[model samples]
Target: MLKRTRKHIKQLKRSITQSLNTPGRPTLPQDELNIIERIRKAAAANNQNNITRTQAYFNFYQNHPEVHWALLAHLVSRNAGWNMTDLKGEYLPKLLTDQEQVDFFAFLERGNWLIFQDAYPQLLLYEESKKQKRPLFHLLDPLNISKFMKPFWENMWSNERKEELTIALIINEQQYIEKRVIHNTHYKNKVLDTIMFKLQDVLDFNHILIPYTTPLQQKTKLVGGTVHHFSSVEDRITLGKGLYDLLFSVQSRLTQTVKWAETNPHTGSRKDYWPDLFNDVKESTPGQVHELKSSPCSLQVKASRIYSPSLPSVWKDWEHNKAEPGDWYPNKKMFHFVKQPIKQLSGDIEKTYCETIEELEMAAFTKNTFFHKK
Candidate 1:
């Protein structure tokens, strides 16, 4: 009987230990776990509050079927020079309005992921074909163009940008295509015709080209080559000029901003640099931009006025501050304080303080005043 009891106790202990270990719980692969952790960190860095960040991560995970770690790594790579937090606080704000920032970031976070699935495979195919000296091209729309061009802008000061000759390459391709069509028609050219026929499949692709900027990089400079299609010559001209303008503007302004930020002893590493840009007001001295509004206290106060307790009442007697002390007295029918049941601790009596509307108003005003000063 004693041996049987001991055996039963051992079995119970084993079962309890197994249950505590959570044997039934599903486990994720190491790579997937790493991606999830990165996403969590990214969301936290981007959002203002913990609750918002947590909700955003859940929403992102639920919406995206799978995570592409490679694509994510590319976006956050040192070569890319993108800070995910800056997308919300700096980059997007330049491209979008205040109202559009939230939805745009959410869209960008997921949209890029979806695009990556389609893009990465094509990029791989292009890479392989390029080795055999085969022509491979891809079409670039507004979204992907920005992604492709961003890296070039990042290396603006480097010799790689000049050697890549992005604009010159596109011009060469355009001239080659036009000249070949005309030349083939001018003479009976079977070889050129056959080559063009073979390329016809991918000819319409909006091809983008990246440059080999770094030796340590695994990626190549020749990304995609293709004929760009436009509705009209005027539109094409406008877009071409626009592309050059965008590159030039970003290159000039970003170079200046970075130099200022890095060299200025007053500007700390943690300081935000975006607000200092695009002021367009040049200082009497060089390399200084005008400062915009530091804080949105005025805007906040203006917005709060609509819903504030201080707003005029529809009925004069029902105003927020019109309530009498008698109305809040014990057992009063008009208005009464419902006393919360208190638990005695160490035989001590504690005073319960009730907050008043006037006090709340004063507090809000004080907070606003403090914000305005900063």
Candidate 2:
């Protein structure tokens, strides 16, 4: 596996080098330029928020079902939405200050937004390529996508290597965000390096959940894995690959998960998946003691639902700083993330999540009761 990954990386690096050495832009026909303009417009339009981005991915998957990563991205983007709304949700406001919540949301939103803008155009261009019935990936440079991806897209078109294409995209996007979000000095201090972010790690908030329904059951069942070290590009890639396998390896999972996404549009609320445990509508008054009637995975028969707000309710759209130029493919060490086998993960996170919430609530209650004198 290591040898094969090394060879692949060598090939990718050579392609990148060649792309760099040959720098002049190729002249495109007016029709292709028009197609590119339309793709850019579509990407920008859908890049508004988590809801739009999630819907865009699902819609793209519907049109190009062969691109398995679109479905995976849609589900993962749903989790991103849930995570964004979580800052304003019942427990987090107690833990994070208003500014801190804003900072954290910006972090998540920036990464989410960046990925959509970068990947959506690629998806649209691929659609155009299918329409043109030829490889049009040379347009990738014009789209401002990383040269690292051009080789993979070319290979995907010629060889029809779907899994490789998926993995390549996973690597490309993770690396894309590594410097722009994870390692950005501002975010490093404001969000990633903060104690609250560490608390998120300790509380297992990094778990990515994919909801699917079984043949006999209409209720949603989650099947997803967690990424332990979000800062590491390699770990994110590994998590992405694992998720891709989990989603596509099982036919029923793919079908049912798509159905769940289609039936429940993403509103940036956990209620989209588990309405019994979560509600977009606030049921309890803020800062008031409410009875905790929920267990690990469910609420009691009459328990009030927990508040999980929609994205727009809390955060307006943000215009990000222009992405810093340069690609993140610097070494062969990245290949370690490429071909490794990830252990299959089970979706038993409700108990862990509930326990984390309880722990956060306890800490908040203690802080409020003792630290803040009325």
Candidate 3:
């Protein structure tokens, strides 16, 4: 009986090991796991933002006892080409009322949008000062485009929708005030030039309109398990073009400003060694021989006859041009220029993505399914 019981335990252990070793699901990296953890935690909370809504489905799967299996089954079916029609008699539909499902889906769509935004971080504007020599500030996102479009997204999934959704892209510029004093540590000039560098008020706030429209008159089905519905190929392409133009416009302005800052000539203090002839000659008496000293003041003692006006042009130039300021030079090394997007340009950014949704759909379907092959 002891041997039989041991054999039974071994068989159970083998089964468990086999289940654990099942393939298909790739192991997530530590960073991705951390992101997922944050997502799950945020979704589990009563209050969740537009970004955490997709994760709430998983939260429900883990916490909701009776509705868990129903949600899982529906997810599997949807993945296998079954639309929302497969949700019949599911506990998920019963527990989460119709309106709640709509709300959840809306947040899910917004969450996907947030993911795109996070992928392309905001641009960093670096201050070109010694004291404040770092990323000064970031522009955009103050307009809050995602939050602004939330109200218009209500009828996005509706079968009957009329007007085109309008979105705004705003650019707000900040200027340096030149307030903080910069001490010239490298310059050897006698005069200590302390320049103040500070940031000033914001200006040149402008906005552009982006209109989003769908070509489909019928109710479009949700794809890829997300709340985002399907639009026409032409419509998607036009939206892509508009976003590209908008982003390029903003980027061009930033690039031009940075180039100007880097290439523009600015007069600054620089140090250079000069002979202490002025103080040395004044202090030394004619009777005693003046010994050369190299302490606080660097000086070379010579016969009083060497100070004659008949000296070479080189010596005369050096003597006359001593303790002068530096000439104008480009301020290229002062600041760092990084061309990154502040806010994720609205809609599907095809540049960062592998292919457009239209291309993806075309690839998925057979030539006969849509129409004659091109």
TM values, all candidates: 0.21, 0.93, 0.17
* lDDT accuracy of residue 360 in candidate 1: 27
List residue ranges in candidate 3 displaced over 4 A: 1-23, 28-32, 39-230, 249-374
Ranking by TM-score: 2, 1, 3
Please provide, for model 2 over 251-363, each residue's C-alpha lDDT reduced to its tens digit, 9 standing for 90 to 100. Answer: 87788988888888889999888887779899987675334665636664677777889989988888877767876665546655556665565556656667766776676
Backbone clashes (count) for model 2: 0
Better of 1 and 3 by TM-score: 1
Against the true structure, candidate 3 reaches a TM-score of 0.17
Arranged by lDDT with the best first, the candidates are: 2, 1, 3
Error of 3 at 292 (Å): 87
The root-mean-square deviation over C-alpha atoms between each candidate and the true structure, in angstroms, is 32.4, 2.4, 35.5
lDDT of 1: 0.26
Candidate 3 lDDT, 208-239, residue by residue in tens: 11111122432111112111111122222233
